[model samples]
Target: MSVKISLFISVIIIIVFSAGTFFLVSQQTSRLEDELLYRAKIQSVLGAETVATIIEEAIDNGVFSVNEAFDTDYQIFGNFDPPKYHTSYDSYLDRAILSIQDKFLKDDNLIYAVAADRNGYVPTHNTRYQQSITGDPEKDRVRNRTKGIFNDPVGIKAAENKEEGFQQIYHRDTGEVAWDVASPITVKGKHWGGFRVGVELSSISAAQTQLVKAMGLIMILILVVSLLFTFLYVTKAMAPLRKMTVVARNIAKGNELESEIPVTRKDEIGELQDALNRLRLSILIALKRKKGK
Candidate 1:
């Protein structure tokens, strides 16, 4: 009976521990993901505002020809597979906008921050993505992807976004899943393109994984402690009952020697102890009267 009670209490503790651990882990993971997403949104918006200012300065300084940009447009001029584009405006981006893009890349969780024209053409990617071409299509796709048009669903949506902000989760050209936040970039009240900040999901997943492991360890510790406490408590509570069992056996065998069942507790177990003591005294008296007669 004591073992049964201990087992029941241990099961309850395990249920509570499991539920609490799951809730805590889920809540922490959600908070962290929200924080990362918020940072990504801010970086994109701020980056867009800065890049727009730089483009306006270049146009004013005659470094970027606005009319030539509108006329030449995003036309393919190079012979490389996946090709390079021209709008008479890309060179200025390399000189003026690349630094701003690189600055946003320094923020945690962000993989790439770049500006693309309305037609989904990236003028100048960050220095890290501008690796020299190795001519293998597979290698070039991963290494030298600059001057390429990102026409995929997520890319096109970000490039043409005109709202205060736009967000999406999609696969990157480098084949990693990421969260993208984009803000429109305009010059002299005319929409030029959009600026995007890409946050890598692996970074967020790694943090969540570590958090779960820590929580799991804590839950295991708590469970072990609770089980030990249940075992000790049940054993102590059943000690008096075990002793009463031996006293009852001695009375049934008509043994001349029997120990008194004295109990300190005032609960049901103590009541049973008092009743058993009175019965033993009555039987001893009745036997003595019979022998005298």
Candidate 2:
């Protein structure tokens, strides 16, 4: 057909492909977010339970006290030395706990840890917790939340079930959320308090965002390649049409119309070229008749 019509079809194909790509990308983003959030929540719970079991074992053997190991003056895990008077068991247990904390830090999702008495007193924590909760307020909040066995869900659950763990979502800061995991510290069937761990949503959210951006870049690259190919295809298809235009222009300028359009495909453009050839023959016949007259 005409060049204008061919270009219109190409534009329509491009639009349809673009819309399909956008919809697929949007669905992929949603699925990724949902799966990441669910996995983050489950991972937080597993981490808290695992660490609590280690602490409970140590406590059972009388190796360490919740208060002594995590006191302000005592730093167990990173670069800090264990107390000189600590028993061999204490040192082993402290090292184990520090190793767990180090692993949590390495994971991008982890946020905080809370070890409190039946009362919600902040005990041991990770770096994110230290940054989020302020000095005395952090302690007071924990204490207050644990005062009435009813105040803290994790506290009460741990106290009641004497189980290893519980998980929940906590709004730690305005417009920010964390997945909290807590496990009971029971020594010889007696629950002393519990251990809590918090995994921030931001880490997972940021990862998802980065993934979407990378996918977007890939889509843009594909579109660019498709556009390049389409331009090439259109240019090739229009070559015969351009030849026809030159022949018509020559005929208009009183030059001989000897060249035939070379388009062989039986499409609308081919049909139009054939009609032009017929019209040229009719014009030549009229010129011969007038010359004889």
Candidate 3:
């Protein structure tokens, strides 16, 4: 076969293999993303249940009233707002929620573990967000929130639906992406609020990118090996054809046979070699008869 034909066949093989590899990698990455989201949702649901249980227990023990714990009225001081006070029961509940948040954060994938009341008031937040406000609006929005109101659409949706769902949010300042899953919190058969668990997707995205790059590298290596083997095999297989072409040219120029065509193959090449030998013998016999006459 011509070099061009050989190279074309190799290119086609490479294309087919590369396409298959790409499809498989894409599927694997998609599954991984789904698993990550699934785990996030489960965590959110569990956290919501735990918070609900704590609140219910506090109420049953008569340590705090449900109405008092969820009270929205803020006690305003004269000029400067004095530090807000929490009953011992409320403090106990807060510590329990904080402990849950800390445990979740240890996984590194979890971004936030928080619960909001029906009115979107977050009574407890992650330990990092529990820090005192530094008077920075942007920073305070993320941190320093015990009785802070978060009337965002996500919070309201979770409270209204009382079902587990997913959400995505982007931070413009940091260009951060957050994947959130929310589940409703119920206390004593009453809809209290919801618990939200957020996962930062930047790490997951980076991991996916790395996986794609690795797959691409493997494809390149396989392609190179395939091409190399194809080139060598094509060259070896066509060497006998090249020899036959040269022998035919000499016979056409009325030159004496220099060497017999090698018939080492048991395939079509061997058959062609036998036919050429017979033709050469017939020509020699005809020339002898003409000379004798």
Q: Tell me the spans in candidate 2 whose CA falls farther than 4 Å from its real position.
A: 1-18, 55-98, 114-122, 127-169, 173-176, 181-196, 252-254, 258-266
TM, every model: 0.87, 0.63, 0.84
Q: For every model in order, what is the number of clashing pairs?
A: 0, 2, 0
Candidate scoring better on lDDT of 1 and 3 = 1
TM-score of 1: 0.87
The C-alpha lDDT values of all candidates are: 0.83, 0.56, 0.72
> Could you give candidate 1's per-residue lDDT for residues 1-293 as a string of tens digits?
88999999998998999999999999999998988888888888898899888878877888856765443357787577788887687877788878878888787688889988777788888888888877787787777777878888998899889975588997976689998889998878878778888888999999899999998998898899889988999999898998788787787776643466676679988888888787787777887898999
Which candidate wins on lDDT?
Answer: 1
Better of 1 and 2 by lDDT: 1
Q: For candidate 3, lDDT tens digit of each residue in 1-293?
A: 65976789798988898888889789979987888889888888888888888888878888778776565565432221223333334456676678876787776777777877776666666788677767666676556555555566755665555777555553423245677678888877878778877778887887788888888888889888988888888888888888877777777764655456667778988887888777677777777888999
**Candidate 3 — which residues are off by over 4 angstroms?**
74-90, 143-146, 166-175, 254-258, 289-293
Backbone clashes in model 3, listed as residue pairs = none
Residue-wise C-alpha lDDT for candidate 2, range 1-293, written one tens digit per residue: 44665567668766876787678767887887676556554554555566567766666667766554443342233221111122223345445655565465665566544444454433443433323223355353342221112235644554344445466676752345876666665544556566665666787678768876877787778777776677678778778878778777776664675555455769977887787777676777777898999
